[model samples]
Target: MAGPRAFAAAASLSMLFALSPATAQTPPTESIQIGLSTDAISITAGFSGADLTIFGSLENPDPLIARQGRYDVVVVLEGPPRPVVVRRKDRVLGVWINLDSEAFENVPVSYSVATTRPLQDIAEPAKYKQLSLGAQNLYMKPVDETDSPATIEEFTAALRERKTATGLYSENVGGVQFLSQNLFRATVRLAPNVPVGTHKARAFLFKSGMFVKESSAQLEIRKSGFEQSIFRVAHDYSFLYGVFAVSLAMLTGWLGRLIFRKD
Candidate 1:
């Protein structure tokens, strides 16, 4: 009787072991989708204070597994002949301030990403990692007659000139190191003296010093009303002061003339 019972128990355990492979062999469902705000975007001349939106989608196919989702979005603006400046404002308490800036002329713009979901629930984090979100230069025309399409030599020369002109502004801010991949935010600040015109900017992705993909965007710098206001103020001040001085002189001369006529 004891031998029979022990053999039966061993047989049950063997059957459970046989079923474990089937349970473990179930494939994980892929539940993520990616889309852009548009297939293409365009910016016209004198464009400023413009906002570009990037859109993406996430879906879950498995009903049993509850999933949490998160994403990291990076926008890089690139220009070939000249470097473009990207700036982001950080809110501290109530005041907003410029947080950081990064310049990319010859090189590509790059940053890292982190999601809100855990690794297990991400479905395919590696797939999201492979997705490229950036731009490239199709063509860059000169803004001025003297200025020509930028060559490699011209780019290098402009970089040197920029360094000399600006004398290196902020290196780091808000405890974020500039040019560090660890941080998600980076930008390139346009020089104050940057010529006022339309400039082409491109965006691209890079891994291990090799180009993976590319896209393109545009940047336009035109005279603002604020600039005109400054000149208006100066002209008004000059005209008012001149009129006041002339009125004072005339009044004095009139008083002298009346006194001499009485004498």
Candidate 2:
């Protein structure tokens, strides 16, 4: 009887020890989640640029890493893709002429990046290139692949410069802030001429200079009020709208002549 009792006690002790390790261990994987206050936004006419705020959270984050500030986040708002043609103008007999051109397919109309730190400090350039991130690293595939590499590179640089000048491509360092151990906020700029389409907002997480996870959300940007109505009419009734525009112009010209004709 004593031997059987001792054996049963040892077996229970072993089983408890085995289960303790499993319960004490937390999964090492961490993920990111982002949310938008609204799924769509309206842009009225004569509106200047504005900042858009995005909130996010870290899931299953390691407290130690968070406390040490080893975690980083990068947020990006990408506008809809469309075909673009980049033309180069050069002096021709003292008048600028469209000399050369390059066409690219599926170019992003706008791209805004907000990061916890400067991009170079967050990760290697190769990583960003691999992710097709940042205005400088984004890949712009040329429509004519057979074009000389030098020409393509020049046009690509020109396109990026033009977008930057227009406030369509931007980067904001230190735009992301950690509100708490697991919560973060990011602010990205929206240009006044932001395209009306479906945009995607993405968040990337990095831990100790290593990519951890990513998450995304969708947003719709569209015009509102009188401008929106006119836009819809122009697209939905092109022929009628054109006729009305022509007639209105003609009437304006005749009225101007009558109002101030030299006697």
Candidate 3:
């Protein structure tokens, strides 16, 4: 028979060998998930400007993970019938200079952000295009210009070679560029001749040439008195003002009649 002490020691050594492995294996990388919050999803249209909120998560199976890397998030505007472009430029010696190396004429409106590490990022791409209701009227205001006024030929040439159209009038004033990334603000001035109506403008984001996400808002343009009357009473003020006016008039007439009868 084996000694009790020797047998116990042997069993313990066997258990240790079974429990421990010779080499460690790395776990698989977890897929990344990106999305916008509910509050971020909803937006009000017909404003001069608005901000969009983006939130996402990078998940890894292993707790020890690397999230420090540069990423590009792009937002794109898809629609409203006529193509639109917003260009940003700097004023140098009274001349309008293109802020972005690449010209954006006939190209969709896009906003981009570059970030390092995992955290919340917030950006507001001000309004460069506003569409009117009925998809007839469109309003575009280009960023302020600083450099010398551009000639029609120069401007036309720039437009012909550009990727997007900056509506009827293009301005290079009051625009700012993103310091960290190749970002800029361009103004697009809509022609006064734009037809009045409601329009739709889409927003989208892209990264590494791949479409990532998208959103949209409505643009309500008021031009004629009839259009303005219908839009204001129906949507803007909800007919409250009209109702109050009618009620007040009725009350005043009733009081006058009662007083006259007593007299």
Best candidate according to TM-score: 2
Candidate 3 ranges with C-alpha deviation above 4 Å: 1-27, 39-46, 61-106, 110-114, 117-263
Tens digit of per-residue lDDT, candidate 1, span 106-133? 3322111222222223333343334422
Candidate 3 residue-wise lDDT, 17-118, digit = tens: 121233236543333332322311111222222222223332222222222223223222223233444355989899999764322223223222213211
TM-score of 2: 0.85
TM-score of each: 0.27, 0.85, 0.26
lDDT of 2 by residue, 1-263 (tens): 11111100010011111123453485557888888867788777766778888888887777788999999999999999999999999999999999999999999999999999999998999998998988899999999999999999999999999999999999999999998777788888888788989999999999988888999889898777787789899999999999999999999999999999986
Candidates sorted by lDDT, best first: 2, 1, 3
- The segments of candidate 2 whose C-alpha lies over 4 angstroms from its true place after superposition are 1-26, 249-263
Ten-residue region with minimum lDDT total, candidate 3: 6-15
Which residue window of length 10 is worst by lDDT in model 1?
4-13
Ranking by TM-score: 2, 1, 3
lDDT of 2 at 146: 100
Give Cα-based local distance difference scores for all models: 0.33, 0.85, 0.32
- Candidate 2, after superposition: displacement of residue 94 in Å? 3.2
For candidate 1, give the lDDT of residue 200.
39
